[model samples]
Target chain A: MRKEVRVAGFGGQGVILAGVILAQASGAIEGREVAQTQSYGPEARGGAARCDVVISDKRILYPKVRQADLLLAMSQPALAKYAVDLDAAKGKVVIDSTLVNELPDGLPPVYRVPATKIAEEEFKNRIVANMVMLGALARVDDVVAYDSLKRAVAENVAPKFRDLNLAALDRGYQAVEGPGLRPAAGANDAPGAPASGGR
Target chain B: MSEDGRKVRIIQGNEASVEGAIAAGCRFFAGYPITPASEIAELMSRRLPPVGGTFLQMEDEIASINAVIGASWGGAKACTASSGPGISLMQEGVGYAAETETPCVVINVMRGGPATGQPTISSQQDIYQARYGGHGDYEIIALVPSSAQEAYDLTIKAFNLAEEFRVPVYLLSDEIVGHTRERVVMGGPIEVRERVAPPKEGYRPYAAGPDGLLPGMPAFNDGYRLLVEGQHHDERGIRAGDDVNKSAALVQRLNDKVRKNIDRITDVERVDLDDAEVAVVCFGSTARPALEAVQSAREKGVKAGALRLRVIWPFPEKVVAELAGRARTLIVPEMNIGKLVLEVRRSAGGRAEVISLPRLGGALHTPEEVEGAIMDAVKGGNAR
Candidate 1:
């Protein structure tokens, strides 16, 4: 299956890092062709940062993802920016519930999780909010294996924050969901069958 | 797939140039960061030190070229790289290298520019700058590589040409050739060219032979006291500006050496021109896409062909003139605002209808765009 995802937020929110992890995990673990590209202007302060990752069994023609299958928004600005362009045919919108007051309705399958509060309050670090979001993404849609993502994170995260980010990922995977939360399409009965280490 | 017993891997053009430079025995590099060209510097920094070579990120482009020249004089095959604006800052130093007869490679990954025009934008605007940007009437050897393979292959050639002729060689690349990712083969053992040593017994650094050129030069402490400078000099490298005869002789020899050896540096790739009525003349980054367009046009029975120029400086005038003689119409497309198209029109001898398709800033004209221009040329347009 083809998966094209865009992770976007403020410049320092680790959204780009999340997209890179997803691309790396998909390529190295699933053995799929992946293209990860980020676009940002010169300014470092409060600028919009977006990274697009496209995973496919076939060759990726263009590096940029025009219509994203999944839009993971970490801030209100990110949601406002990418909500219109999400492919509703196969897209899922995941938002940070704490930062977002009202979720934009009539989108693809919506999952609102308190990503920032979970990372900062439960995991005791705000920087791993993107990792928490990635964990929630793995639980919602088995697009990438959680163990494969953890290996990807361990391989890519800066040495000082590796352990904290792993903990953040675990906390996110175990979070609560409302009644009758349907798993993503094509999810396997075998636990984390898409990912490695049987997690 | 294996061709010539080598594996192909996807790599960017800038990385291909870096690998090419490494394969060409370039052991010393000094450069500053510039968009569309930074990957060359970055890869050099990573790859050079492990192989007992050196790479330095200089403070600016001037310092970068200066350091490379210093490294070249220290008996190392050295190189520096930059984009258009940075290249402009290095012209004075580049002219100094020319006057001193230093052998070094300078890679200019051309970008859109007037003054910081657009940092991320791509253009082939550095053609004039590469040939005539430096002060005076000195001839520079410039190689234009059209693809990732050429970016790797011509770099070794660039070094050999520079050392053999005692001149600075510029690898003129643009954004398309710099950033495009394609298949490149590496790890092939290259046939290296060693520099020719000067004759013993009172060797003169600037002495003109019967052919009006300086012969091979030996390094310092090689049993000869070689005096080199940026000024007009006599046989022994002493400043000879006061004497008009010596200055004229020095300048004439410098020009003749390159002018006499144009055949050694001239290279061109021709495709489907035997029965063509219209031709597309282009160089550097525009050549590949234009050639693709020409092939598509030919399949549609438009009788179009392409001439991809490999040598920008010394301007492959003979081949261009020859190709122009055969075709009824010639269209020249460039990324800059009509820099090389003018040269094509001037050199084609007005035998063919020369058309200029110029695009400014970073945007590259797609193959369909060139196809439209080819169709226009097929419609009996007047010569420019």
Candidate 2:
């Protein structure tokens, strides 16, 4: 089986790094075929940025993601831009509730997690918001094992920030089982509605 | 393989090229910073010095290519990389390397262009430029890699070919392949070809041996007084610009060296072409979608296949003609406005209907688009 994941946010949110980590988890740690590609623009930070990761049991033919199976939007602009590209019927949408305050109607099972809020309130650093979203993604989708992601996070992040990032990942993973935080099954609610239950 | 057994890692194409260069004994890298290809220079800068090699960041692409040529003459495997604008600037140097018979590698991680078009977007627009970018009549070997693994493998092959043929070789990668990260399996240590040195008695630098190719070159500082110049030179490395016969012979030898060994130099990968009614001809990153389209078309009972040109230059004419003889139609898809397709048509010789599917605007052709073209080719059914 082949799975395509799109991670999008403004630059400096570690969107590209998150995509790389996902690719490493599947490709290097789990010994699967993976391809990750990102868009580079003139703006270094605070501009629109996105990355696509393709994980496959066999070799990947087309590396680019035509229709993403999993869409992780960390910003409202990214959500507005890439939401239409997701598989509307079967694709899963994961968004950061703190930043993306709006959601388009008629999306596959949407999972909302206040990634940046948890990163700032608990870890006192908002840069690990993408890691939080990744953690939540692992819980919603069992395509990639949790151990593989943890190992990938440890291997990819900077040596100095490795500990805090690991903590952020754990917190994000635990947040999936937190009170009222679950994968909403086909429920189209307001933009910042709390998570319902796991898919 | 990381100094151990078989190793696997996730790396981008640019990074893979660096690893491949290192494996191929490329110790000298000189390049100016350019987007899409900058990561190569960055990795080289960080890696070369620690491996007892030299990395120089030249002021411009001209200086970079010249420096690479100089390093090659100094008896070191050398390379330089850039995108389209920088590659255009280095055309003069590339021509000089070709004429002077310098063995060096030029990596063109191609981006969109007529000029400074798009820095980060990918394009195979440099297909024509790579083959005929230099002034005058000359042939250079160019390889197109589709994935990170091929990027690594083909780079080693590029360096080997550069040394073997004594010509400036090119790895024509696009931004998509250059920047895309994928899983790459590292092979065992590659066998690097050592440049042969001439005997002490009666050594002529530019003279062709019995095989009609220049003799192995001695390094500049290796007790051999060498005169390396862009102008036409005689067998003894002296200026022969006034001697028309000498000039003609020198140029012919340079061209003949590669042309004679075309079959050995050309590399291509064919897929599902046995009973194919339609064939998709493509190269580089574009091959990814083309292969997918071919498979999808086959599922729908269209006898479609694909021929991916790993070695873009030397044209692989015989293979193209053979495929044309078998398939009823040939579909050439490229990111450019119809560069390689023209070559396909020329080689096809009207034996098969050649169709061009051109995509510009810095976007790759999706499989759906290529499938549509394949379906149209099958429906047209106008094969002679």
Candidate 3:
């Protein structure tokens, strides 16, 4: 199967890092083929930045997202710019509700995850907002499992911030759907572990 | 996999090239960093020391290229990398390295042309610059990688080819391949050739044997008087440019050595070409879309195939010639304005219709865009 995802936001929002984490999880942890490419305007920060990822069980011919199956817009401008061209009815659009408060009318299925606000309030660290957004994405997108995403986050971030990133991911993931994917025990369950300890 | 276990990770093309260089026994790196290619130098700065290699960030591209030559002479497999402008600055050093027969690697992560055109973008504009950049009539090997995995594998091949041929091998990459991150298996059995060590009695640095390869490298501290003369040198590395006969022969020998071994240096990939009516010849990141377009065209009942060039240097003329013989039309899609297409047209030589599908600015030709060209070629739309 083939899946393409585009993540866009302002610079320093870690849009590229989120895409990298997603791709690494799909490719390294899950043993799939993946490619992650990014683009940014001419500015160190506060400019438009985006990363495109393509994941496939087979070799990915066209690396870039020809048309995004999913668009994770972390800002208002990103949503406004991307949502228009999207296949509204078919594609999934997840916006960070904290920054992107007003979504344009005549939209498809839109899931709201206030990643930044949750990062600031619950986690007391705004840096992990991207992780929160990724968590929410894993919940909505059934292509990749949450366990794989968590493992990728651990590999990407430094050791000091690994636990924080993983926690933010878990919160964002459960934020969209309470036990949306597997059972609640699956979160802490090790891979290939026998399904035991049922009440 | 080396002594250690297998290592599979997501790495950028530049970072992968660094890993390949280390695996291929490249111990010296001297470069002036530029956009899209900066990660190579940054990784080298950190990765080289631990592996018993030296990383020197030179003042400029010219100095960086010169330092690479010096390091090679000092018995280190060395390399330097840059974008278009830095490569332009190192043109003189390139000719010098070719004339002196120094075994080194110079990676050109090509960007938009003529100057520092587009640092953060991708362009294959340096096809001519890589093959015929220097003033001298010499042939250097160039490997063009379309993906991060090839970027790693080809870099190791570039160093091996440089050592075996005793010439400056160019890893001609671009921003897309350099910056894009992909799955690259880092540890495996890699083939690395050792530098030839000649007899100490009578060492001729500029002499080629029956295999058209110059004698073993005369490392500076290896107890041999070393003289590396850039301007037309004789067998003993003496200043023989004044000797018209010897100078001309030396220059011709430099060209002949690489040309004679072109068969081994050329690397190309053919997909579904046995019954192809139209062939799409592509390299670099452009090959990705070209391959997709070929398959998409086949779905549309067009007999199309794709030939992806792994090693862009030595022109891969033989394979292209055979492809031209089979395919009725040949389409060349590239980021630049019809550079490699010229070679294709010449090699095709009326055997097949050659078309140029060029994309400018920062964007690459989409698979749909390339398929349109394939359809056009099959319908005899852009036959030239």
Better of 1 and 2 by TM-score: 2
Model 2: CAPRI class = medium
Tell me the lDDT of model 3 at A103: 80
lDDT at B109 for candidate 1?
89
* Candidate 2 lDDT, B31-87, residue by residue in tens: 999998999999999999999999999999999999999999998999999999999
Q: How many residue pairs clash in each candidate?
A: 1, 2, 0
DockQ of each: 0.11, 0.78, 0.64
True contacts kept of each: 0.00, 0.86, 0.77
Where is the poorest 10-residue window by lDDT in model 2 chain A?
Answer: A183-192
What TM-score against the true fold does each predicted structure earn? 0.75, 0.95, 0.94
Clashes in model 2: which pairs? A182-A197, A183-A197
> Over 4 Å off in model 3, which ranges?
A177-199, B1-5, B381-384
Which candidate do you rate higher for lDDT, 2 or 3? 2
Better of 2 and 3 by DockQ: 2
Lowest-scoring 10 consecutive residues by lDDT in candidate 2 chain B? B208-217
Off by over 4 Å in 1: A1-40, A44-199, B1-7, B208-213, B381-384
Report the C-alpha lDDT of model 1 over A1-199, residue by residue, as the tens digit: 6677889888888887888788768876666777665655445657888877878786543344668888888889889878888987677877877776666666777777788999888877788898888987787676788888999889889888899988787666655232234443343323322332111
Cα lDDT of candidate 1 equals 0.79
